[model samples]
Target: MKRHNAGELPLSAPAGDAKRGLGKEEAAEQGKVDRYGKGRVRWSRLCFLFAVVSTACVVARHCYDAGLGRGNSAAVVRIDAVPGPPRKIIPIARGEPSEEPRHRDPPSPPGDDATSSSSGSDEPDDIDDGAGAASSSKQLPSPSKAAAHGHQQAGHPFARALAAADNKADLCGGQYIYVQELPARFNKDIVQYCDKLSPWTDMCRYTANGGFGPLLRGGKAAFQGAGAGWYDTHEHALDVVFHERIKRYECLTEDASLAAAVFVPVYAGLDVARHLWGNNVSARDELALDLANVLAQRPEWRAMGGRDHFFVAGRTTWDFRRKPGAHAGWGSTLLNLPAVNNMTALVVEASPWHLNDIAIPYSTAFHPASDEDLFFWQDRVRALHRRYLFSFAGLPRPGDAKSIEGRLVDQCKASPACSVMECSTTGPDNKCESPAAVMKLFQSSTFCLLPRGSTDTLRAAFDALLAGCIPVFFHPASAYVQYTWHLPKNHVDYSVYIPEEDVRKNASVEETLRKISPEMVTTMRDNVVGLIPSVTYGDATSRIETTVKDAFDIAVAAVIDKVTKLRRGIVEGRAEEEKLEKYSWKYPLLAQGQKAEDHHEWDPLFN
Candidate 1:
């Protein structure tokens, strides 16, 4: 439970003389003293020197291979902007520093705090000291140096690509996601926010990759596979999708002038979860209110009333929209705030009624590095001689009167052809918690049961698709009404819909599944495989090429496209009247034709 400061190294054991009783702090300080200056050579110092030498060697070798920080020159395109002058596009040699005097916008300054006091007292100290200004500006890191530094942090495979892209134009039709450099308190420092999300359990593991959590076991030979990709499982960790995607977004740029949309990387999901159980309204809403206030002062907000700025949440929109006097309940009234309502909000489970709330894909287990890896897995699943007709992998909710999970569990357990991975029989050996085990079950079955979870959407559906198993849903809201962008226009093509009414009436799920022809099942499975790429989140550690669009690509493109249209509307003075509508008529509502009776209550599923 100890909180460490930013950039502070954790304590390690002492190397020499355990009987000397030297404290860790003393040992660390002693390791830095020169032997010639009133001290003998300490073992710690020698170890430190050795580590420093090894790191330097690795950095040097990497830079050499990358053709960076060397005299060898290449052409690079640079954008030059001066106050009250027309911007010019000029070509310059690599490593050649520009002399036109770099002027950065107020919020874009390096290492600047995202949240500062209104008096502006926390402004960067370097701004006022005229004596060191020019020299300091000249010392600014080049693209090569930045890449080298990025490598040292974690050796992210995309560091080289990031360096190579220094001169490349934004590929998002010139749109870029301007990531806010907020203070640790807003995001990183508060990762311990995980520990307080709920009262009983410690949730620190969910905070990895800025709250994305750890990578999943991608495949049997993921590390050795050709075009191998990264995969991770955040089964209950929905917030991780936004955290990882924002960091890996290709259109991300630090330059404000090139930015079409800005991302406020507030760990809002974690921030609000900690306060949900507490009854105090002010306590639940403190950070959100602060975020709205700080963002309002930014020049970008003043320009468009925050229409171009957005944030993503791992939870549902309802979790943050608790209204006053109506109910003393869980969650904060964040979405109800005036400032946040003006801006867009992407949630894992969006409200069907909210216009600004965009429903994005929940993070699944497969995070492939390349298209080849994805195709390889898809082929493997297609080749699987599935033994089970259908499978269900979930815990039974016996308490809920509306839930059919218990009945499905009973039917699945009783059926000879079904492969059931029951979570209700809790123990250390529960295979349901294991990603590999769950994937194996899905791959062995023709269809994976996806009952309605506490939320409308569940990560299990995405998992089923990733494993090349057709998802069988009982509710239209489960998949048909949600994740329209990543799914086929015709839900019947990729999934099976057994209406809740039929299940409630004790209709046979096994009989329904057995009726489908083998050819039809193969077609449905193929359709599910095709959707793998779109629903999968790529590895955050590397930049891998994929033929099919991934979730990150789709989300970025959608946000930019909507922002562009909205900006255009505003320019024409029709901002208020303009609304972005679903344009998936290209894939007409095949769901309607497939089952007219099921589409009665959920007509939006057709749209």
Candidate 2:
């Protein structure tokens, strides 16, 4: 082999041969380089594919663990298969708990600490669960929707949670109330024609100042302390008064879901009062029927079927429980309605036989503005020097010749120790109409006689308590059965009960009362003074500054407690088994067996 440059052909060869030899050698070297380069490129591509697949697997695993892959296995695979650049994954913050499904009771909105302002539109928006998962397209179900859906929305988790939270922090101890926004015809329209509400007197004045009537004047000197709380309140103004008081209720919630009880402000008493004197049964019943139908259609009413629903009747239960086919009956058949039978009625006088009827005190002249004022009045009454041993203040009931009112009045007039303020049937001489004169007489007496009025109960008993006068009852129905919630359980603690029969048989009222020792009388008077707050309605114009429960407070609490128990009983399926009618007249006081009719042959009286 001759020595030569790298690309040079050997000597003594043909030019074509050398050229061809160089070409072949160069081609062979290029082939080796191309093969090696192609192999390296393929290996690099294989490594990149492996890395991408491994990264996708890790991401899919994470998505599955995070609950995003639930019910979608294809989604996990699709994450890697999508024709897009790789996405950057951000890790969750350290120490943060993983997102999980949780169920909690919902809470109501914050209550109005002061006066309740309008809650805006009647229909509220559906509350969210705070998870940001609710679709914007969803809306609160309408009443019709709720009806068709069987009140499914009432059981919504979000609403339940809100209610639970509000209940926990409620000043009313889980007793939240919801007032329905009814048509004006149901309440306000009737109130507008206050003068026409009563067939006799002009009720417009009494309806003023939130149904507390006019501010009482000329008698402030008689009241203790500043005497700023007294009002010339009418006896039948409880419906308006209660409505006004509830409007300022501290625990009022706009959301119905959170309500422990629902209030249907129908002004049932006023409605019935308008048609009471007339014989038009249709006129009396039409509005009540309409109210029943309206309430029955509500979602709130559907929740408990009116069992947890209540309203102020402002009159005796008899005023609303007119017998069917008695076209000339005394009042509208409101209480007898199928819809009303299930609901609770707070009245001035409750029926002894009806479980749904609850007795609340009639509106008295004294409405204490604050706890201090109440205490002052209590002390003032306690310190008074009573002049008369006993007193009577009322007109004789007409047409009831069997009534013992005549004998009692005669006995009172004959006794030098008794002060009698006789009321004329029709004239300015009707001392019973004057709150000032009546309270004065009651205040001056050691004991006040409480005989049966149009019904078995009388507002005078409460007036006597307000005046720190021990009540002398001729019948148990006058106070014991009617005011079980307001009065002490033992009748002897605050009142004297002499059988009506004994009084009719010429028993001496003065001699019987004089027999009670002075010390015992003092003790009873002290008890009567102590019960003033519970029997007296507070001024609705402002909130009570102290914790002392007034008549309004006591009634509302009892109603709330009752409704709560009723709802619980319904939920536990025991409400149907508890027969309220089977119990006795003293059901609330004695539980059973003791009867109002058993004493003084009172069976025919209720019938």
What residue pairs clash in candidate 2, if any at all?
105-161, 106-160, 106-161, 106-162, 106-163, 107-161, 107-162, 107-163, 108-162
Full-model lDDT for every candidate: 0.64, 0.72
Native RMSD of candidate 1 (Å): 25.5
TM-score of each: 0.67, 0.74
Task: Identify the leading candidate in terms of lDDT.
Answer: 2
**TM match of model 2 to true structure:** 0.74
Give the local distance difference test score of model 1.
0.64
lDDT of 1 by residue, 1-607 (tens): 9988967977765655642776878766666563444444466688899999999999977776666646576533345753231122122222344333443233322222222322355442221101100112222233454334333322111122222223233233234566655667777755755677666545676566544455554546322343234344454455555666677665555444335667887878777777777778788888888988888776545434666678887777778888744357767888878788778887877765556677778776666666667778788777778888899987788788888988999999998889888874545577775666777788888889999867778777887888888899998778776676778767889888999879999999999988888899888888888888888777656655546778877877787666666544433335344332342222223443453233344555335
The TM-score of predicted model 1 comes to 0.67
Stretches off by above 4 angstroms in model 2 are 1-173, 224-226, 324-326, 570-577, 580-584, 591-607
